[model samples]
Target: MMYISRRERFSAAHKLWNYEFSDEKNIEIYDKCANANFHGHNYELIVTLRGEIDKSTGYVFDLKKLSEILNQRVINKLDHKNLNLDVDFLKDLIPTAENIAFAIWNEIEAELKTANCQLHKIKLIETENNFVEYYGQMQS
Candidate 1:
């Protein structure tokens, strides 16, 4: 099996705060990320596909088609939006990198399946030092 990856960029803002927690506790747990206002990240998203290369096409996935599915399903929905409020798919979830990566995989996995590909991984680069990798399914 082989893996093909596509990289896309987006900017978004979020604040990691739990309403049930006291402000001091939330700040202690999330630190600067729990700021009342918000902060933004120039996020880099990597979507990976795993499958055998098609014999006729010599490609695991058609880059053009894959790009369209990604843009329509993921980028358009996430770019420049407030993850805490504006994104329907992300409602009620903390907009942390881990959750965002998982959310992204959920948004695009079905389209990949239709195109004969499986979503192998989602790597979200929230900052140079902070990133998260998510596999669509839980491991045993």
Candidate 2:
């Protein structure tokens, strides 16, 4: 089996505070990330797909097709937007990099089925110091 990965980027804003927490507690736990004004990041995402190469196409999955999916389904919604407010999938969900990475996985998992490839992994980089990687729940 072979795995192909795509890199994409978006800029978005979010605040890490939970409304259920007291203001002081939110500040204590989330530090400056809980700021009422929110904050933005140049988020980097790496999406990987796993499958055997098609005999006819000689590709595990086409990069052009994957790019379209990432652009239309993910980037168009996330780029230059507010993750806490502007993203529909994230409504009432925290916009931390971990959550965002999972959300992106969920958003695109079904679509990838058409190409006979599995959504293999997601690596989300929120900053130079912070990133998260999630391998899907199974492997083949």
Top-lDDT candidate index? 2
Candidate 2: tens digits of C-alpha lDDT, residues 26-57: 99999999989999999999999999889899
Q: Give me candidate 2's TM-score against the actual structure.
A: 0.95
Question: Cα lDDT of model 2 overall?
Answer: 0.90
Superposed model 1: Cα runs more than 4 Å off? 114-116
Query: What TM-score goes with each of the models?
Result: 0.94, 0.95
The models' CA-based lDDT, in order, is: 0.89, 0.90
RMSD of 1: 1.4
* Candidate 1 structure quality by residue, lDDT tens digits, 1-140: 88999999999999998899998899999999997899999999999899988888999998788888888888898899988989988998999999999888888888788454688999999999989998878768
Runs of candidate 2 with Cα error greater than 4 angstroms are 138-140
Model 1 is weakest, by summed lDDT over 10 consecutive residues, at 108-117
Model 2 root mean square deviation, Cα atoms: 1.6
Number of clashes in every candidate structure?
0, 0
